[model samples]
Target: MSDKPKTPLLDKVSYPADLKGLSREELKQVADELRTEVIDAVSVTGGHLGAGLGVIELTVALHAVFDTPEDRLIWDVGHQAYPHKVLTGRRDRIRTLRQKNGLSGFTRRVESEYDPFGAAHSSTSISAGLGMAVGAQLSGKKRNVVAVIGDGAITAGMAYEAMNNAGAMDARLIVVLNDNDMSIAAPTGAMRAHLAKLVSGPTYRGLRHTAKQIAKALPPIFHEPARRAEEFTRGFFTGGTLFEELGFYYVGPIDGHNLDHLIPVLENVRDAEEGPILVHAITKKGKGYGPAEAAADKYHGVNKFNVITGAQAKAPSNAPSYTSVFAQSLITEAREDERIVAVTAAMPSGTGLDKFAEHFPTRTFDVGIAEQHAVTFAAGLACEGLKPFVAIYSTFLQRAYDQVVHDVALQGLPVRFAIDRAGHVGADGPTHAGNYDSAYLGAIPGMVLMAAGDEAELKHMVATAAAYDQGPIAFRYPRGDGLGVEMPERGLVLPIGKGRILREGSTVAILSYGTRLGEVLAAAERLAAFGLNPTIADARFMKPLDEVLIRRLAAEHEVLLTVEEGSIGGFSSHVATYLAANGLLDSGHLRFRPMMIGDRYAEQGSVDGMYGEDHLDRNGIVATVLRALGNEAEAMRILNAGRD
Candidate 1:
């Protein structure tokens, strides 16, 4: 028998509506139970822990105060929505969080009515909530729209843009700034400093009394003047003048963990009929869990762990992770070159720029949650004749596409892009997947695109990018550890637009891009048992395709198969286009097959599981090869045997 926490109060309530009947004191008890439930669930599921734990009191208060489903509550980034999920009638499946076909790690509108807007990316909740509020106003509905955004998320330019628009239109939107003092990485920039001043300053406590006095003393005609005076006074004291200028009624710096303070304040805000309001609630990232609180990152994301010891279980691996390799490689390159600099957008640790920062702190720039700004800033540095390496995750690079096109690529700036998490990132699911970067970047003219086959290749590419000064160049690598290839003391810059043949054979040719080369090799080994020795080649550069090698392979081999970790319109598409344009595919002799990620959103699971589901694994690759060679029966047999 399994041991579960005793939650008599939590047992009574399944949804937010059930909390309406409970007393304030009972609700406080319910909050405690909710916290325990969240810890227990996450302990097993191994997901975002500290963010959800910090928001337990806030989550309970919001649900108890607001009529949810009717009142739209959007959580920015959704890392902190685990507690929200537990309360929104998803407790039964909480253990299955981030598993395939199970509850998503983040908020999804399709999952429940309570999640009115889906969110995985940050700084989008306020905009979404404001839209909902405006739509309600247009339809003659009086429903409340509350957007709970974290301090980290608010640092993004998108959050401020939404705030500006909401304030200008005087939209009836409630934006809860969950000031936990941290995002995935520790918060940075001037905005963080301003928020810190607001929380610690006595001005926050004095504003309410002064505002009330001004409102009471002023007559009907003097109301506008009195309000402005109040705004200036509050702004002068607490540094909330900026928020007021943006058109939001600034209302907080209160203790988010205290239900005594939280309930009444939320109730007041819920009843207010004013312009967009910004409630800045100060809370800890990890409030209750001692282990989480003591940790530097507050256990932002965690693996499955022992409940008592709080020691997370990580799978043992001898190979170094791609992130660590990239960091080390960059460090090696930076040591020799004085002009080399590193840039990241609020993800120094995640993108492995922390190591670079340790060596060259002055040279590293962490523009907080601003991808667009990061790209343009790097471009600006490049304009001054500096080699700027913009290290960012693939999904995040999508946010700065315009900057890449106009500021970097079009201008022909020699900015190096070290795109991490370049393919399917497991557990984070579709939202964090880097499935589109290849297609997006490949479409742009004068862009040099490369995918690393292994850690050694990645090092070479890093060296290649550092040396290349012609135009924008981007190289991608996957999430986990690289294949345990032999290491080089220093990386060698290979010739541009060239590929290397790994194994030479007769009947078929398997052309692979990125980390999928390992799987292709494994499939080739399996094919050898059937007396079919297929040729395997690694196309290191996707853009400026290796025409000579590809054409030679086409002429020699009966079938040419292309595989990549990216979606359609990526490396394979480029290869096919080149083949078609050159009259290679038009020749009746050559058979062509391109394998990529299927056209659909993949759910959260292990990386290998996602590849298997998409039929891009070793077994799938073997089957694809067999079927293409007019052996359908053999292909089906191989697939079925692997399943069995």
Candidate 2:
């Protein structure tokens, strides 16, 4: 802690070119300054804190060593790219991280030239980076391509597939294995232990050097014997005999924190004459900072917090988050039903299965980063007469869409999907937004798709899923706090395909589902002020829709408007399809306007800010309803007598 209040060299640096003139000694000082700057920026904005903190040194080192914009660098998840953003001409916009029409939380190709490949999903970097590397090789371009992947991200099958192909192709690529010992939660599966042995354990380097020297000395007649010596030595030391088998020359288990070692090791890997390589750089999760180190997972992706105590600065919650509600409800249902089990892929706390695991340890399964396996595993469980509740984030569940369709839906297995984060998830931006689940799930035959309007309804949906043994069922809920409604102490299963009418009116009907119901109600109130009494109905089930209610409403109301937080193919489209098929499309000019998440990806921002920008909020919904009525301009506009 300097008493003079040292200004960060990193703050002054706007691009990789600015860091060019500085000596290697000065670069380390810049790294320290960048760490402080990252901490400060994330504290105010409340973005992905722990990951950015973990990669401060690595970001600095890579930029220092590699020609960034020219030499393409792809970050796996982009949660760790905050510091990279800061270094690459976006420092001033750092405060606007995740804000709609502002800077994105994840790396975007449009956001900066340095970011050649952008991602919010995990295990994609290796493939993307390898593709770029091969392209560069074919184009005869002189540039290094590096993919920095966390140990946790490496568990996904795609990363290994990329490694295997990159190795076989012998593409000029550098893979920096940033082993941080955690994902959103502690990593599961054998890959973790294997990485621990190869990256964290010593004895990785001496064998590499010895093998190279032995290969050089061997004559043409002794070529086969020399190859055997290298293989034996690799088996003796690196134990990762796996990377070698894949065709990558593995070097490391190096200290990522020490710049002395990191810079030189990176330089060597960059200079390495031929073939693909893996530099295993071991690092702490929340490095340098004491409070962050203590509770890495909590700080991993956080809201604004006090820097001194690491306490999340806030007001007391009016209601528990939807995640907590889902977890608690599942626990209660699982208690009575011995056949019920829970599953999550990589996320325990985020999906709220941490509590379920505590209570029903044996029944709860964390299947690592493999979402495809988790869904198929649930189908397997369902096959054996066990009820499997596969709790996954909506965005991640997209990875297992085929399994949900082929295995669960096709077989009509009773697998309950508790789809969390099913709407505009703030700060993480477009890549992470849970905008596709509703549409994708609804399209699968034999799948019962439901959405919760509020937390109270979420309880009912959970209970409903547990009781329903008909086929594959799913219920989606948004991220963050629930509406301040009194929660039911006892879980009661609601009737499937049934919706509740919250408010009644005549001229128009506003149909809503999931978190956006609050906006619809607000729009209804606005409509009433203008002498337009709109009927507001909470259409809870997306699939097996309340056809009876829909037909009656279309007959009664002048306009039937449907709104949901998902994409074009979601709830609204389902309503349109239903109307067209049932001869309701000819039911006069009923003016059916379906509102949903639009063509573009929703960016991270204040929940209200994103909703406003995307026209998913109260004012936007009201405007749409008003426009439909042809009474938006003048509230008192009267209809012509006997027009029809």
Candidate 3:
């Protein structure tokens, strides 16, 4: 009675082993069904739709030919692993993708044995697979290690490092370059152009076939030369010369969508006793879906959508997003200062630099998925007396810490870091959580770290970063929409190491950093209902500690609670350390508490849901206040009462 498409072939073949028993034609039918299933499941749950659809045939072919669970098949970025997940006995739970306590948006090793190495970040698969291959070889175990990486991922320097090492190691490894010619954004740099050229070049099918026949007829001495000639002939026409030079046996610009082209080529690669192999498969992103294929980004990530209309379901929000606020604020700053420029690592649109790019086309720089290079590049711009705002998500910026420390912080370069998603980003899960930036960056001596309380504050912080030339400064804002506060006509740069009191109260004081101020305010109102009015203050700067304000609050209030949307050793930790080191806790009259994200990694869910689960929401905050007031039983009762 259900309206879901009948996946008879897919249902019959639950696992890769089941697929091996089917004929080539039947396997092609299975790929079609698999593609349909992925679309349908994504329509229900909303996730990385296009990437999964693009790799349906390739997923089937790889699993069918190779022995998975035994053979390590690592997927780069893991956005394209939905079809792979479905084939690996996870079809029953496929529709729960990205939901609370359900499947992850990206591949996770804990989720399945099929996924050997967990990956959400790009360009890590090759390195992981190579390590596995080398380990297996050393351990005297017989198993294949295949790394399915995209052209976008391969552009990262880490991929090249892995390839270079793998090449020299001569380990039995297979690197499948899924050249869809698109990352999240359109691929950038010379590598993209090179991949495009290789795909459009002369066919290597005839040359490869002829070379194989000739090699079969030739003697052992001539075989090596004949093989080298074959490689050279293909390299000459199709441009896999770079891969060949890396000591990989290069094969194909094969049609990834076509099972006929894919199965045989994959079979040969699997059977071949080569040191290392690189298989180039040309496929269209969002291959089977018309709407996804026609879209600019190929619907790389999507909200739940109507399967028929392909119109995604977007949650209505009145407030502007934090990303847009940052973009507009930066743009306004740039209008006055000609030296101001913007830089992003692959995520021009995601980081809101695409708008900056439109206005100041020459000034906006997208350095691909290379964060390490992007940071040092911004440092160089800063060295030339240009104010460079390096806008990157906090999770991505973690990849460039060395550059931040050595090139920027150590040298005291004034490169502005605009860290977006500076809290627990829902749906994408722990892998993409921006929870550690505050703790990590705050540890650097000269680094000025600030968090925005709202959209208006974010604008001010942007202006503050633009005006500050003291040293390397960073500002963080959470994901999703603002708190619908009134926008300032123009941004005003607040004094460094300053905080503002929102309310005046006696018994308890709640000091908040970042957008968690809203929740703190709500909790303050709840406490007021229980005959307890708490003082609320927004500590603007995390690094400088706002010692004057903190010491005054500690001396005046009976209970002082420090709240932040970060890990343990963040704003709260700094406050606690400052309070303790200065002997503020010697009196024992003041009860100090630091509320933050706990010691464990949080699961994917709605932002509010995650916050509530972590007990950092309004109710949770109120409960913390109750416990601090010596009503521990009452605090537990309030928390057990449920969501506000």
Candidate 4:
């Protein structure tokens, strides 16, 4: 038997334009095939399994009704777009999803014409979709615009902004609330409760509308009191008049899994004219997948696994991942200090705050994909003398740069930023890489930055951040497993602006930070084979620059090299700036080359694959060091050097 899925109707769909001709019965078959294909594809490739499975019917219904590509479709936080990708001509390459030089795990504009606006970040779809809608109207496009947002994503302030603006303008836009009753963790807040009431009520919508029309028809003298009474009653009955008052024709609380209800409602919304509309479709996060549905996070995004068994592939080692290490370290610190509370931007599970959330439910705050708010919220918590660990990925923290600078740094809040994914994040690609955290964070005054070389270093860094109460501090760690170094049962706080010398050399010094130390040490070993002893210094802190150790090394060595896995203005540049300013330039023929992720949008690849492609791997580092040391002949001997 062949492994190829039966794509009878799905194979026929070359574009959304072909979808309109299909009968409702035929479309239902297409949805079934799409779901099966998605499950099959994910079972092999293993990226974003649950989210795509949840939206199979909705994807079918949207394409079946709307003129996508011509009419814009923006998918919020795009993990749900695997089914959308499969339907829109990427089905064959689906098995290569999230792999190097293959289909993206999330929606991409370059991948398809159907995705008018691409999104990997959550809560951005509504705002971007609104922009497309407004732009379309301005340009006389008159095309339909829709933003399919998750209920979890709906909590962000920007979503409310788009809703408020769209409602006020009455723009011809469709806001499909894909309510799975969960974000990464279970959904929280008053807004979630409001949505629950709307879904639970039987005849509240009918009664509220009848009263509204009656109030509008009342006599002039009684208009004011009647209007006030109607407003009060409307608020009492329909829990979603908040959206209604903003100008959206709210019609939903419909079963999203049911094609019977979704198709007709989407069709009606597509045909309707005057203003913005909200169609609340109740969905299960891992609908049709029993194992995923049973999981706590609805298996929101999963690693590669066996489809039949629903078992993820066994890891090669029992070593702890950088994320788990950070979680354990933080938990240890939080236990000692009750003032240390954790905050995450709709990524409790992703950032490993879920562990913290489980232990201290009241202390862990999941701020719901609002990176900007999470930063300022931490600042607020800090103002009240609470120690807040704002655990955010480096990529997501980029979204709140202004907040970090203005709110936290300016006010001198002791916000301990547990920066996860601080280097080349494989598979999820450039969009998810934590490549610029060092440079950006270093730019702020009173901001201390550190990176971990291994799990033991990470534990100390965590303790350092917790102990520092003067200003904001951040500790960055990579995505995957640590180097299997023995972790201390308890952490020790390292001195600020201090470093340890790993190897002693006469001519050249290789100053490295974070996870790049492992590679630097490997390069040192290779150089040692050639009777070249290179001094390797582990510069623990980025901001303060470990000036004592650097100055000592710079004075003795004939050549100096700074290595970091960030961009242009990172640690290397900072070292250069400090050397130049302090008149240490021209000392030992000072060779400053930062082995960092250069200025480019990197593609999906393995860690080594991307590192080599970008020329930031250990061999690249050795080659760059050799060239800087005026040993070009020696540099050529470094096996991996290519492309100048």
Q: What TM-score against the true fold does each predicted structure earn?
A: 0.94, 0.90, 0.93, 0.92
Q: What C-alpha lDDT does candidate 1 achieve relative to the native structure?
A: 0.89
Off by over 4 Å in 2: 1-5, 182-228, 587-589, 634-644
lDDT for 307 in candidate 2 is 71
Off by over 4 Å in 4: 182-239, 296-298, 637-644
Off by over 4 Å in 3: 182-231, 296-298
Clashing pairs in 1: none
Per-residue lDDT tens digits for candidate 2, residues 242-270, read 77778887765656776766776677667
Higher-ranked by TM-score: 3 or 4: 3
The TM-score-based order of candidates, best leading, equals 1, 3, 4, 2
RMSDs, each prediction?
4.3, 5.4, 4.6, 4.2
lDDT of 4 by residue, 532-634 (tens): 7999999989888888888898888877877778887888888888898898885546665657787998888888788877656678777877787677887
Q: What is the lDDT of residue 121 in candidate 3?
A: 93
Model 4 quality (TM-score): 0.92
* Model 1: per-residue Cα lDDT over 1-644, one tens digit each: 15889999998889999999999899999999999998888889898898898899999999999999899999987989999998999999999999888899999988999889889989999889999999999999998899999848988999999998999885679999898873322333445434434432345435655676777787878878877876776665444577888998776566788787777777777776666888777778878999998873738889998878899988888889999999999999999998999999989998899999999999999998999999999999999999999999999999999999999999999999999998899999999999999999999999999999999999999999999999999999999998899989888998999999999999899999999999999999999988899999999999889999999999999999999999999999999999999999887798999999988998888899899877789999999988988999999998888767
Pairs of colliding residues, candidate 3: none
For candidate 3, the TM-score is 0.93
Residue 556: error of model 1 in Å?
0.6
Name the best candidate (by TM-score): 1
